[model samples]
Target: MQTSNDIRTPAEIYDELFVPALFQQWAAVVLDAAKINPSSKVLDVACGTGVLALAAAGRVGTGGKVSALDASPEMLGVARRKSVRIEWHEGVAESLPFEDNTFDAVVSQFGIMFFRDRIAALKEMMRVLRRGGSLAVAVCDSLDHSPGYSTFAKLLERLFGTPVADAFRAPFVLGNPETLLSLCNDAGIENAQVRQHSGQVRFASIASLVSTERACAWTLGGMLDDQQFEELSREAELALQPFAGENGDIAFEMPALIITAHRP
Candidate 1:
């Protein structure tokens, strides 16, 4: 599974598939545990497009600072354009560019699951947090609970083949609570609480969804050439036929996990 950073031009990748509502959905989870305050210093790891970082900045107020880091230069570029106050930097989760006890809170949204070295990344997150500081992260649950993706995945597998579907499932690593908890424990984070939440992932239309997937180039990247792309698109349209309503509107349920922990 390729991490978001590993994908070429992650910033554009996000802007395409990750709609504004999706950000709001995940931000609610991240903010709930973030406990942002006027004096808090925040760090957002793998801060794609600065969604969480921007939300954190608003919560922390002008007195506080937010450092948004990502391995992809393109991602940082998008994040930079969003806000000048955010200290955007190019860095990986395994080796964050920050001092120990530097931040009052550390957060990530849909990022922890993609780290090549999950344990190392969590430890690094712990290292940067001040004593008793909180760590809040949002990750997707398994595809079973994620209706939109699950259906899309099944269709892709049946039509485009299993390999194409496998690529999409790669990034959803922490879809299980036990697996997530084990990773946290390995990183020395204890007493973590996991919460389940549901959000609506709306698509303008089936064509729009397919177009966005093509633009992101994560799941379908390299796997599909021109011919395959057209075939997959047609297959997806057929699969989505059942979901189409009178107005041609389609929405999918996106279930996510909000995992929060406090540094000892």
Candidate 2:
């Protein structure tokens, strides 16, 4: 599924569907962990569709500066549509565009796992942050611990192959606390603190989950053939049946780590 590395869909789907489904749960947590102030200059690294960045902008008010960066122009375009006050840049996290000590805080949610050079990105983030400024990053726990994604990946593996299944598992690769701490130490950021956090992911129905993945999950969607898709869909429905709620909503607990530290 790495072959689909550059795949992209309408960015609206991400802001509308994916954000509400998962990322919104941790948006406030990122700001709270970072302890950002109204007048602080902030940078949101890899700010896909500007959820965290927008949230930060709200906190910063007119006195503060909020800048968001992502490698994808498509994502940035969607983010730009939402707010004109927040500065949006198109760039990779490994090499930030601004000079050193530019931002009072740096935050990212579920973005670090995909960085090509994790330590380089962390170092860049630290370099941009002022002394005593905080860093807050959230990485999803392993799929084995995430019932919804784990079950979907297993179904994909059974239906097609391990490559696709492994692709589903990629986001959770850096979930371990040791990895988070190690990244900080390697980046030369001091006094790192990693916190384990659990949040409930609620979907209106299993169909909500399925439809979002089918359209926007770059690693999994548009790979299967006609017959294969039918088989996968049927199996997925069966797999989700046990998790359905009284109102047909599907809710599952997702484990994640919020790594916070300050530049010193």
Candidate 3:
């Protein structure tokens, strides 16, 4: 249960690994649930690198505004560079800076799971959203469903024991729909619809995957120390030996979830 602030440098964490593929898959799903309109003022909470915010900007167009907020200044910086129109704010999800009922819709992707006070963050999201406004959030389904990472996890557990595996489990808190739905209810969001999605996780090589993990030190990178890190990296490379192809590319499928809710 690490707070976003506990991870001091998100820019370093996200430089290599990003939500690009995941975002592309879920953005449409989120937008569909959000029911975006040209006149809708959107708030993207914990908007990392502005994937949803940028997509929201496209949906809102010139008539509306997109206010993207994240605790990580580095993330906000990257998001800012992509689109000047998006009003990027350095803030946390637990306490939003905007006025009450400021947004026509509020959306988050893989963000709510990281909140230290989940209820407070959701309440804030609900508070800022206008009555009848929509809330769409996407979270990782479960570790079992994510084979690319699941296999890696099993291997890591075999090597490092359960403690390390438990640390990795935090990011997949909402993997279960029942738990996620209960959390939504706790936050006062009703009538939530959970949708299932899957995407391909591609790596140019085993080395590429390891590099990406090092670059994005959020979860995978954070768990390992210098010795453990090198050991795991070498193990991963060895594990991928069977999958290595003529071009040395390896790809796998990872499961994802798109959980959407609305204010009653």
lDDT of 3: 0.77
For model 2, the superposed segments whose C-alpha errors exceed 4 Å read 1-8
On a 0 to 100 scale, what is the lDDT of residue 255 in model 3?
66
Winning model by lDDT: 2
TM-score of candidate 3 versus the correct structure, residues matched by position = 0.87
Candidate 2 has a TM-score of 0.93
Query: What are the clash counts of all predictions, listed in order?
Result: 0, 0, 2
Stretches off by above 4 angstroms in model 3 are: 1-16, 240-246
> 232 in model 1: Cα distance from truth in Å?
1.8
- Candidate maximizing TM-score: 2
| lDDT for residue 34 in candidate 3, whole number 0-100 | 86
Descending-lDDT candidate ranking: 2, 1, 3
Worst lDDT window (10 residues) for model 2?
1-10
What TM-score against the true fold does each predicted structure earn?
0.92, 0.93, 0.87
Candidate 2 lDDT by residue in tens digits, 1-38: 32232354557777777888789878888999999999
lDDT of candidate 3 over 1-264, digit per residue (tens)? 543424546563353344643455677678878888999999999898887898889988999999999998878877787888999999999999999888889998888878889888988988998888888888877888766667777777887888776666656778888887788789887777777777666667877666555445455656666678678778988776665567987677666676676666
Error of 3 at 14 (Å): 1.9
- The Cα local distance difference test for each model comes to 0.80, 0.84, 0.77
Residue pairs in clash, model 2: none
**Candidates arranged by TM-score, highest first:** 2, 1, 3
